[model samples]
Target: MSSKSLQARYEAAFMPNYGVPPTVLVSGEGCVVRDADGESYLDLIGGIAVTSLGHGHRGLTAAIAEQAGSIAHTSNLFVNEPEIELAEELLSLLGGDARVFLSNSGTEANECALKMAIKFGKQHGRTYFVAAENGFHGRSMGALSLTGKAAIREPFGPFAADVRFVPFGDAEALRAAVGPECAAVFLEPTQGEGGVVPAPEGYFKAVREICTDAGALLVLDEIQSAIGRSGAWFAHQLEDIRPDILTLAKGLGGGLPIGACVGFGSAATIFAKGDHGSTFGGNPVSAAAALCVLKTIASDGLLGHARTLGEQWAAELAAVGHPLLLGVRGRGLWIGLVLDGAHAGAVQEAAKAAGFLVNAVQPDVVRLAPPLIITAEQARSFTAALPGILDSASPQE
Candidate 1:
């Protein structure tokens, strides 16, 4: 069928909350995906940073297939080898004494962490939360309460009371907001959806101190920035600080769906069993996929590759000095290109026309989170073509 026909069928069968997808993706390999119409485009967004190793990775597929043929589900009633092994691998990667609660998506991970935070507060007679404005958590009730975006969060309203919002990257605001009544302070080391904003210098370190003093749990949402997406094992590692509770997902399973909520120090013992559970959170197949992703990322040295190539792409784009360009920020393969005006949608459409895929994360911000395995030659192709793409969008006088 054609793209139009597929789109019609999709709209008829599914809700329009996500809007009609622009392309009907048929198959993908490496960094390129073919639409139903047979046109191929470079997948620079990596499915919004979920496809860590890129499309159709041999090892990733093999791991999933092998695990599937053996066994796929065992529920929480029974333990599975791949699930246990995945937990061990994750704890090792995080490099600390922690307890892991597996889940099916980033929001579920945040939900687990949120419950832990609230429970910790209950123990000490506290009942409040702090999160960054414009930050994107998950969409579930508990996780949505921690998200900072008003447009997406407010309508769900009258959320859990005492939830406080602070300016993104402002240590002072965070410090002022977190107090004795605060149960936890939720933050993202790098704000992936808030135009790929990074924490200011000394911010994470200061927040750590403030949370410690206030006796509040520090919850770092690394859903989008973890697993080498930001050129580091964890974004918090780049800041040299550790959170009491850490939420991870997105790239953990490459393309498969899996998430984890990990607790450290006193936070590790917050849950007292029977408090929560997930039916298919870390099933054998997904666990195996996640294990493969972590192993491949470590052995392939994709962290350094993401950092080096990302820096080079930033420099190249900056050198062009296009009329719509403002600046670029972010680390590793996760980048946000800020435009002069609200022209990101225009640029995204133009790039799609030119056989490239990018995300208009915000009105004026274009976020690029290509697969970590994307080569320099492939990346420079987009960078080289960017000037023309920008010109086609909004040309200067």
Candidate 2:
């Protein structure tokens, strides 16, 4: 169907939650997508960082097909080989002996983490959770309670109680907020949905210490920063600290949906057999797909590739020398362009016109989370087109 016809059908049938569709994408390959109008775009957003291996990745496709043909799902009542293997692989990647609870998305992973935190807190007589301002965990009641955005939370009144908000990147403020009453200190290693902000130096360490002092669980929400997006396998690895609970999603299954709540040490033992469960959480097909993603990332050395490309892309963007370009922030494949003015929306529109895809995370921040498999040539193509995009969108002097 044509883009307009599909859009009309969508408007008539679908819920109005996401507003109008941006474009009706017909197909994709690697880091490029073709819209219904047959215009090909360099997809830098990678479906909001979910397509880790990019579109139509052969390994992922084969893995999913093979697993589905063999056994798609058996529910939580029966143990599945693929799910067990995927869990072991994820724990191995984190460099620790940890326990993993599978889920379907970032929100569900966080919900599980929050429940685990509450259980841990009950064991120690604490009930409060400390999160950072502008931080986004998820939209579920438990995760939403920890999310610090008022606009998103205001509409959903009476969330899970006892969540305290502290300023992001302010170690002192976090120290002041985390006390004996706090159950967990929740934070994103690098804030993705909140304009790609990274916590300041020593901030996470301070949070760890504070949580330790208060006997609260230190939970790191790496849903957007994990799976080699941030050079390291996990963003927190760069800081040399281990979180009590780590939540992951996005790139874990390449394009398929999967999330994991991994717990370390005592946090690992908090969830008893009957404490929590999900029927489709560990579906064999999704778990098999995730295993392929992990193996492909390791065998292809995508971690080093992401780090090198990130530095190269950031340098190229900085060299554009546009007055509106303020600075660049974030690590590895996860990056954000800080605009001198609130021209992110304009720039994004211009970029689309130039056959590139990007996201304006905030009024002044443009986020880029290209696939781990993106080539240097593709990066250069986007970088080369960016100057003209910026020039076209520049405010009239």
Candidate 3:
């Protein structure tokens, strides 16, 4: 079918949650995608950082095919070999004896973590959860309650209570807000949706101390910043801090839908028998895919590759010296370009026109999370196209 016709059908049949579609992407290979009309575009956004190995990675494809051919799914009642291996690999990467609760997406992971927090709190007489301002957890009622954006929360009236918001990057604010009544302190190591902002130095340590003092769990939402996206197995590792509960999803399955809520030490034992479960959680196919992604990343040295490429990519962006470009922030392949004004939307459109995909978090912030396997040539192509794209987005006087 024609792209326009497919889009029309989508509008007529689907919900309006995501608004009008962008382009009807038909196929992809590596970091490039082809539209229905056969136009190719570099996917810098990488499905908002979920497509870690980019589209149609051979190892991941083969793993999925092999697993599906053998045993696709057996539900959570029966323990699966792939699930066991994936959990073991994840725990090993995190450098801890963590028990994992696998799910289908980031929201489900957060939901499970939140429930575990509540259970942990109830056992110890705590009830509140303190999250950072401009922090985003998920859209579920429990996760939404912890999210800091009031505009989104206000519309969903009478949400789960006992959740408070503190300023991001402010150690003092976190220390002041956390108390004995708090069940957990949640944070995103690097705020992906919040303009790719990183916490100030000593913030994670201070937050960890405060949570320890208050007897609350430290939950780090690493859905966007984990799995070598930030040049580390987890972004929190960059700061030498550890979280009691860690939520991961985005890149874990290498494009397959999978998420894990892992708990360390006492936090790991909060969920008793029948406390929570998911029918499709830890399905063999997704687990096999995740194991393959982890194995590939480790064996191919993609973590170090991401770090090298990210530093060079940031340097190139800095050298561009576009008047509208404010600066670059973030680590690894996850980087954000702050614009001088609210022209990010225009800049993104221009980038798309130039055969590259980017995202505007706010009007003045554009986020780039290319595949971890992106070569230097692809990075240069993006850098070369960026100046022209920025020029086209010049502000009107």
**Highest-scoring model, lDDT:** 1
Q: Which ten residues in a row have the lowest lDDT in candidate 2?
A: 153-162
lDDT, candidates in the order shown? 0.92, 0.91, 0.91
Give the clashing pairs for model 2.
none
Can you write out model 2's per-residue Cα lDDT over 238-291, one digit (the tens) per residue? 898999999999999898989999999989989998999999999999999999
- Sorting all predicted structures by lDDT, with the top scorer first, yields 1, 3, 2
Error of 1 at 18 (Å): 1.4
List candidate 1 segments past 4 Å from native. Answer: 395-397
Tell me model 3's lDDT, rounded to 2 decimals: 0.91
- Candidate 3: the clashing residue pairs are none
Residue pairs in collision within model 1: none
TM-score to true structure, per model: 0.98, 0.98, 0.98
Worst 10 residues of 1 by lDDT: 314-323
What is candidate 1's lDDT per residue for 72-119, written digit by digit as tens?
A: 899999999999999999888788778899999999999999999888
